[model samples]
Target chain A: MNNQFKKGVLDLCVLTILKKGDSYGYDVADTLSGKIQVSDGTVYPILRKLASDGLVSTYLKESQNGPPRKYYHLTDEGAKKLEADKQEWDVFTKAVREILEDEDK
Target chain B: MTKKEYLDKLTKELGSMSYNDVKDILSDIEDHFTVGISAGKTEEDIANDLGDPKALAADYKEGMDLPKILEKKTVNEKKPKAPEPTSATVCFCVLITVFVAIPAFFSLLAVVLTIVLSEIAVALGGIALLAFFWTFGPFKATGLLGGLALIALAVFGYALSYFAVKYFVLGTKWYIAFIRKTWHEGL
Candidate 1:
């Protein structure tokens, strides 16, 4: 996939993954990269950006493993951003699909 | 590449970024490696899956630069330069202080002094009456009562003078502060 295209939607994908539930940094990376063809490291910068933008907040929670994990939670601001970005994504993909179908004819 | 090798490269690639930002990014990547190892992945495989350190650092720098610039702008806007006092303001303050404030202050001081002096005179008169009665062969009861009454009145007068002097000094201080503020900030 083109790097530019992936870069644009990567934020949306991460937000969608977080909408499912609060998850740790590694889990978020795993979930996102499992489906998308991206480097596992991609999600960290996106998470940091989202957090700094006040869309998400993080806290350390004790895990059954060796140490506490940093979990990211969707703030009200994050949820609102997800809703808006989802709508925009839907319209954009639909328009692109239509353009491809027209070209097929 | 091992986790250490990957992190060192990323840190070098993130050149000129703030220390805290670099630390936070490194910690996040470190956590990823720790979890990957626990999940049955080798260090080499995990490092490979994380992609190039240089590219990752570039993404972070891209996202951060704009916000950092905006943050500085907001901080600058928060404290605008305070206006300096104009020559007219200085002239106005000086003229008012010399002509109006000084004369009023002196008149108030004179009034306070008069009250104090009168209180002292009343007290001295009371003492002199008591002494005159004491020296006489027969001390009159009416004279004794008058002396005690004069002394009580002087005591009350002295209390009133004390309050007057206190308020006069306080009012002058308050006026000076008000003028100084006005001189700097305008009326």
Candidate 2:
């Protein structure tokens, strides 16, 4: 995978995870890297940027195993942003796919 | 690398960010390690999977720098430097400084001098009255009483004068010290 393409979708991918449910950074990373070849640490900075941009808000929740864990949840604005990003990604990937698949035609 | 060593390296590479921000980042890293450990992964595997701390730090730096760039741009656009102080402005500043200082100095000097002179006059008057009562006998029988009262008044006056002089001397010393300190450092 091209690093540029991964970097480009990382934000959307992160927002997508939060769009599903409020999850901690580790779970988000796990869910994300399961499909994409993302470095485990990359998700953290993405989460931080998302939070700073008001796309997500974080809170501390006690874990059964250890101390409190930070949980990130999407805000209303974040949901809106996720929708917008989803639309943009759809259009972009569709266009790219059609162009790439043109050879089959 | 072990989780602790990896986290410490990451923290060090992050460098000089806000405490809360650094803590947040470190917690995220810790969370990753914890989840990895729970998933039966080794510390080395998790650390290796995270890639370089320096590169991770650069990603954070990029995100942090975005708003900062926009802020700097807006500030630069909004603010224009005022014209440099002209010689006329410098002259006016000096004039105002002297205008305020000269009258203030003279008034303070006049007040202190008046206090000292009045105290000296009171002392002199008390001594002269005592001497007159002792030498010339208006009432010889009451001479002792009058003399004692005058002597007490003279002592009180002298005490007041002594205090005034001491206060003036100490004030001048403090003023000199303050001025010297400010000169060496700045106002």
Candidate 3:
């Protein structure tokens, strides 16, 4: 897969994951890497970028076995962005699929 | 490498970034190693999966730079927006300038004058470099030296132009993104 393709959608993917539930850095990276062929470290920069962009906010939560872990939650601003991007992605993929399927007819 | 060693290398690679930025990035990497260890993954395995520290540092730097670039208002933004020009507003401003604002006129002139003079200086410097290449060299082969100088100048100019266009496009894209962000933030 093209790294450029991954880079374009990485922020959305991270946002979607956070939209599902608050998650720590490692778990987020792990979950994404499970489904996609990304480097395990790629998600951190995306998370930081999302945080800096006011799309997500971070807070420390105490874990049972270790020190407090940083967890990311989608901000209200992030929720709106996620909705917008999701709509855009849906429209984009629908158009692409139409173009691809038209060749068969 | 051990987790400590990996984090240390990453920390050093991130030198002179704000203490908080460096701390945040390092802590994230540290968390990866910690979680990997608990999940029965070796430090070496986790580090390998993460790839190069230098490459990761560059990504982090880019993320860190994004906010700085977006928040930076240029000199153009600082200049007051001129009011919509009606005939009455234009005549009143002209009268004010002619009668009451001689110093303001000269200050505006000073700004334009500096810009025009610097532009002339740059043009002259380029012309001078093109005209008198042989004077700098005590070499016997003045023709060969001048030819070499011209080639070097061409290459430098080409590289500069290429980079200038590249950066200009990147800046314009960033500006567009900043504008979109402002619209979204308004909501």
Candidate 4:
């Protein structure tokens, strides 16, 4: 995938993941990088940006082993944004797919 | 690259960012490394998967809106935000201005006006004496000398009044500025 393409949707992806449930930085990075061809380091900046934007709120929870983990929770604002952005993404991808299929025929 | 090497590069690449911002970024990365290591990944493996330190720093700089943050910091440094004066401070300033400063200023103003009026009267008196010098028939010499002396005294008085008025105006300006400063920043 193009770096710019991945960067553009990275925020949406991170927000969707947080929408599922609260997760820490490392967990979000692992989950995102598992599916996307991106560096594990990329998620931190996105998480930071989201937190700063008030889309996500973070709180530290004690882990079973090691220091407290900073878990990110999706705020109401973030959920609303995710709903709109997801709809836009679906519409955009469907159009692109139809165009590509037409070319193949 | 090892964790230490990765973090050092990231920190170096994040040059000129605020200390708190840099510290926060470094700590986050450090936490990532710690988690990765616990998850059975070697430092080198984790560092490679995280990609280039420079690129990661660039992403952080971009994502954090560095330009806006840096601009805000520089503006704050250039001109520290003035603290709002409390109600008590406003009351104190008002009281002082009304009871102390206003009265003092008016008194001084009256004194300056008196000096000015006295100087003007003296100058006019000197002129009148000079104009009526011919009327001193027998005491012509006395009248001439007295008129010259009065004119000299009036000239000196005018100079003195000029300085007093100038200083009085300057003092009023200074007092106004002081009051404004006190209004914005208590005491």
Per-candidate interface DockQ score: 0.55, 0.51, 0.46, 0.53
- State the RMSD for candidate 4: 14.8
Going through the candidates in order, what is chain B's TM-score? 0.55, 0.38, 0.35, 0.56
The iRMS of the candidates, in order, is: 0.7, 1.3, 1.1, 0.8
C-alpha lDDT (0 to 100) for residue B62 of candidate 1: 80
**Model 4, which residues run further than 4 Å from truth?**
B68-187
The superposed Cα distance between candidate 4 and the true structure at residue B111, in angstroms, equals: 70
Model 1 compared with the native: what TM-score? 0.58
**For candidate 1, lDDT tens digit of each residue in B47-151?**
999999988887888888645643222224666666898888888999999999999999999999999999999999898887788677476676788789889
- What docking grade applies to model 3? acceptable
lDDT of each residue in B1-187, candidate 2, tens digit only: 9999998988887776777878978878888888778878999999998889888887887788644633222224666654565565555555644785456556767777777677666666656666776788776547556656656776776677677668767866775575445444443
Cα lDDT of model 4 by residue, B1-187, tens digit:
9899999999988777889988988989899988988999999999999989988888888887766645323324666778888998899889989999899999999999999999888888877887687585877777788788888988999998999999999999998999898899787
Distance from true location, Cα of A66 in model 1, Å:
1.3
Q: What is the lDDT of residue B143 in candidate 1?
A: 71
Superposition-based RMSD of candidate 3 using all C-alpha atoms, in angstroms: 23.3
Off by over 4 Å in 1: B66-187
Q: What C-alpha lDDT values do all the predictions have? A: 0.89, 0.79, 0.77, 0.89
| Better candidate number, 2 or 4, judged by TM-score | 4
Docking class of 2: medium
What's the TM-score of chain A alone for every prediction? 0.98, 0.96, 0.95, 0.96
Candidate 4 overall Cα lDDT vs. reference? 0.89
**Residues A10-36 of candidate 4: C-alpha lDDT, one tens digit per residue:** 999999999899999989999999999
